[model samples]
Target: MIDFLTAGLVLGCSAGFSPGPLLMLVISETLTHGTRSGVRVALSPIITDFPIIAATLLLLMNLSGYHGILGGLSLAGGLFVLYTGYHSLTARPVQLDLPKEPPKSLRKGVLTNLLSPHPYLFWITVGAPLLTRSLKVGPAAFVAFIGSFYLCLVGAKIVLALAVGRSRAFMGSRAYLWIMRLLGALLTFFALLLFREGLKLLGVG
Candidate 1:
């Protein structure tokens, strides 16, 4: 239980630290719109997790009866990672024109999260391993684990928002491009590793 909790915390923090499209969204929103916009973007993960968790649960259940489904999932996850990596590498940095009228609704944040496959792919490969494996943890421990995760995730986002707000010039388009490209390369590395493991599981290259 102790190990699981620690691992969960570390995993959550690591995932939150990554400057992916979501983090870019937050930076763009905060710099262009307001801190409120950044907050909305940050919480979009919570909103997006409902269907993803359900789908993961269903997939886990269905695949429990089969030997190869896990490998298939791993391959799919790898493909998604590769695609996102390519996008991140090639995608343009967002420059904010700052709309004169604010977006009154949270539609952009919500819709981006829901429509993207990244969250589902990430949770399927990475998040589920931490949460679902903690069979020894009681309900209280589970709650604590989840609480810690959200604390880390949200805390990171808040810090990022503030940092972007404070140093808008530093985080401007040029830095954004390089950071995103670096992240893309890192994600591509993850893709290759996962793909290799998936091939091993499937007894194929």
Candidate 2:
């Protein structure tokens, strides 16, 4: 249970802080409009991720007994996570040279998140598999992983929006850099674990 929660939190934080279209949209929306707009943008994943979760869960649940397939997915997830971590480690400071756009914060956020491949890839490879396992563990474990995930995921973006709205320097601060690096290291560790799990499932070294 604790392990699931920790994984959820760490993955959520990494996704939230990692440089991406959504994060940029959060900052740009905040800077262009206000904290409220940014917050709405930050809340988009809550709206967009439901169907994704359902679809992936349905697909993965059917294949729960297929360790070979799951092993391949775990390996892919690990690689994707490792790539994300590398991006975090080498992340550049937030660039604030955003062009102004009309303030349809929530609408734009929903669209952007819907169109983005990150959520799909994450859910299919990493999230759904974990969720399936959590379900086998018990209801509480399932809730813990999902709940902690979105809580931190949305929470981090909302906080960033607030920070950017108040002081743009926060995004480009040294503290942000250090935090990203730390998260990157943790993500790398998780990637290795995934690889091991994948190999074990595949009956390989």
Output the number of the TM-score-best candidate.
Answer: 2
Off by over 4 Å in 1: 1-28, 89-92, 102-108, 124-156, 173-178
Model 1: lDDT of residue 33:
82
Whole-model lDDT, model 2: 0.91
Which whole-number lDDT from 0 to 100 does residue 101 have in model 1?
Answer: 42
- The per-model lDDT (C-alpha) reads 0.65, 0.91
TM-score of 1: 0.64
**For this target, which candidate reaches the highest lDDT against the unseen true structure?**
2
Q: What's the TM-score of every candidate structure? A: 0.64, 0.97
Writing each residue's lDDT as its tens digit, candidate 1 over 1-205 gives 1344553454445445455666767777887787877777877777777678777766675565453766676677678767767776785744544444465425666776787766776778755533553433556665666677677676767777777777776454576567557667766776776677567668796
lDDT of 1 at 25: 73
Off by over 4 Å in 2: none
Local error of candidate 1 at residue 167 (angstroms): 4.1
Q: After aligning candidate 2 to the native by TM-score, how far in Å is the CA of 6 from where it should be? A: 0.6
Scored against the true structure, residue 67 in model 2 reaches a CA lDDT of 91
